[model samples]
Target: MSVSHLIKHSAITTGILSLASFGLAASPSQAVSVDFSSWDKLGDVYTQPGEASLSNDNANFQDDSPQASGYYNLSGNNPEEASPNPNLQDFLGLDAESLDDDGQAYEGSAIKSVITAQAGDKLSFEWRFSTNETSNKDFGFFLVNNNVIKLADFTNALQSGTSGSFQTNTGFNTFSYTFNSAGTYNLGFGVVDVGDYVTSSALDVKNGNLEEVPEPTTIVGSLILVSAGLLERSRKKARK
Candidate 1:
């Protein structure tokens, strides 16, 4: 083979080898998870608009009067405390009315993203829903995969719940759903002032994550090695 042809062939083989190596090492299941402690500060994996623009905070929102607390937090109280009061349950619906009767109205905040995933991967988050409207006017936690809506619970309505009065409720209220197929999905999480911000419903969402389930390294490595051999054979043929 001519020197130019050899160089060209070598370059092609190198590219193929590189791609094969990458494909084996980088499995869709092994993609990094997107975790969020609070909406204000999303980690490197997540993306969101300005906090001010999106009221992803522990504030009351309504049409007549919008109460923007201008703060982003996972819960109204310390999550680590023994008797931690997840804001979602402590201050919504009947409880909200007791504080301020007139403040009852629709209040909510939503953040969404397009996540690429593989089968066996999971999307999970911890949330507490507090609402008097258990039937219709309730908290909604959803994941819109493609065009289908997957509810965190059996229904869109999430009733009032908490970790407990004294014990720290770690993993007390968690929502997790595994992906069935490999594809792009639009995942979202938020709290809405169902019915009214007063007859209010609150949702304390935190530790949101997309868990990645990657393929075994040995399998990936084996595939790469096989591809490399093919490339080597092609190089020999070119030389001949």
Candidate 2:
């Protein structure tokens, strides 16, 4: 319970957390680039972080449903293309009938996938929005685990209003959630219509085959040094 003891324990606990993260990352049990149309089994598709194009289109997806099921409709997120939606210059359109004439298939649903993770798990993803949109606008993220304690780690609470694309962004605005208990949790994202007013988008779960990449040899050495320092501090305190 002493201050020095707490410091020593803190270092060890951090090492443990890092180890857990790496373990998850290394495990092949985590999914990667799941097909959006049938994403329930695996995680969902993330489109934007890809190189030239992003598509959860029925083009390669299972069921060929034209649109993925969970994308919520805000301004122009609807896939029907019955009315023309303004396209952003940098944004790619899938299932939107290739409004740019580049010949990319469009499916219109931005809800790429739904994923669930346990404590010490991190969820990282990317998304983009118009300069026309708010900076911190909620793109739709939720927690279903009854025992989750993201409250301690959240930079911001998961907001349910607002609409944009996270599943489609090439770079991710990652959300890290570490759970506190074991149970069947159902973390989900946008599929809500919300009466044609405001809407939200789902995150594309990626880098999901969680693995702890080995730190650089230098980092490993630094860790050893820090451990030694903690031990020295503990010994010094014991002498007093």
lDDT of each: 0.43, 0.33
lDDT string, candidate 2, 115-195, tens digits: 544544444333322111123232222334222111111113233333543322223445444445433444432211111
Query: Candidate 2, which segments miss by more than 4 Å at Cα?
Result: 1-38, 41-118, 129-139, 143-171, 191-205, 209-240
The alpha-carbon deviation from the true structure for residue 153 of candidate 1, after best TM-score superposition, in angstroms, is: 9.2
**lDDT: worst 10-residue window of model 1:** 77-86
Candidate with top lDDT is: 1
How well is each residue in 43-144 modelled by candidate 1, as lDDT tens digits?
111233222111223332231223333223333421110012223223221232222212232344444556688788887765654333433333334535
Residue 39 lDDT, candidate 1, scale 0-100: 36
User: TM-score for every candidate vs. truth?
Assistant: 0.42, 0.29
Over 4 Å off in model 1, which ranges?
A: 1-33, 37-107, 132-136, 146-171, 195-197, 216-240
lDDT at residue 113 of model 1 (Cα atoms): 56
